[model samples]
Target: MTTIARSEVLLCEARFYAFHGVMPQERKVGAEYTVSVTVGYDYAKAAESDEVDDTLNYAELYELVKHEMQQPSKLLEHVALRMGEAIFQKWSQAAYADIRVMKNNPPMGAACAGAGVNLHLVNDKTKKC
Candidate 1:
């Protein structure tokens, strides 16, 4: 039997300040956001080669996330989903991507920590294989 080895690269709690919300104050004053991303890919080549080129570069991933975050979106869910899709589009070798976006101290008229959304996407090619 042939077994496929898989591994994950994660960027956790990447913080950002941006204007994204339905509320007027939120759009004007802006808010802090926390984003996390996980990307899954085959481990064999990178493990054996021990070379940066053999694997997904984390810096590039961060850049992609940052670019997506800069675009204003009313919903965290939209942001998260777009990030996941963008990751897959950039890294064709990636098997899966999971993205999360969080808004801190939202104005809900109560003591609420935050609101967030998570999105998980699988590569179409990976699904076929």
Candidate 2:
């Protein structure tokens, strides 16, 4: 019998000021973005060892997201996708990644909170879309 070791690390609502939108004003003035990332990996070793090296580092993950955010994108979807991909690329041990990018106070004429996009990614190369 075999047991699957699964665990997820979540970074919630990390905020940043970035330029990512279709409107020119939005691109110039920029807007506040909130990014939430979930990383899945085997946690058995980390749990047993209780060492930082045995698990994913949250700071490193944040840096990766920050790097991606610095590069402007026209759409939240693109930013989310890129962040997911970058995380997976940087951390080969990550089995899955979920990224969400939210734009605060979207200028849609209506009194709206924000706009966002969520991206889910798996390590399987053949399964990517």
Candidate 3:
């Protein structure tokens, strides 16, 4: 029997200040945002070889997220979707991507820590396999 191995690399609580909201003030002043990303891939070779090249480079992943954050979006969903698409585009080895973007202390009159969006996507190539 053949067994499939799955592994994930996570980048958590990455904070950024970006313009992403429906309000004009938000676009001008920007807001604090927290982003988290999870990438699923086959790390069997890395586990055995103990080489960075054999696995996904998390630093690169952060760069991708940072790039997306720099672009102004009206909704958190758009930010998260772009981040996920960027991941799959750069790393074909990635089987799936889970992304979350949070806006702190939103304008809405509510007693809450934050509001945000979560996006999960599976690679089309991986589905074929």
Q: Which one wins on lDDT?
A: 3
Residue 11 in model 3: lDDT: 99
Stretches of candidate 2 exceeding 4 Å from the true structure = 1-5, 125-129
Comparing 1 with 3 on TM-score, the higher-scoring candidate is 3
Ranking 2 against 3 by TM-score, winner? 3
Least well predicted 10-residue stretch by lDDT in candidate 2: 120-129
Task: Give the TM-score of each candidate.
Answer: 0.89, 0.89, 0.93
Please list the residue runs of candidate 1 whose C-alpha ends up more than 4 Å from where it truly belongs after superposition: 1-4
**lDDT of model number 2:** 0.85
Clashes of each: 0, 0, 0
Q: Write the per-residue lDDT of candidate 3 for residues 14-123, one digit (tens) a residue.
A: 99999999999999999899999989988888877999999888998999999999999999998998898889899887889989899999889998889999888999
After aligning candidate 2 to the native by TM-score, how far in Å is the CA of 30 from where it should be? 0.5
- The Cα local distance difference test for each model comes to 0.84, 0.85, 0.90
Q: What are the per-residue Cα lDDT tens digits for candidate 2 across 19-107?
A: 88898888899999889999887767777899988888899889999998999888888888888888778777788898888898888
After TM-score superposition, the amount by which residue 36's alpha carbon in candidate 2 deviates from its true location, in angstroms, is: 0.5
Worst 10 residues of 3 by lDDT: 1-10
Clashing pairs in 1: none
Which has the better lDDT: candidate 2, or candidate 3?
Answer: 3
lDDT (Cα, 0-100) at 61 in candidate 3: 90
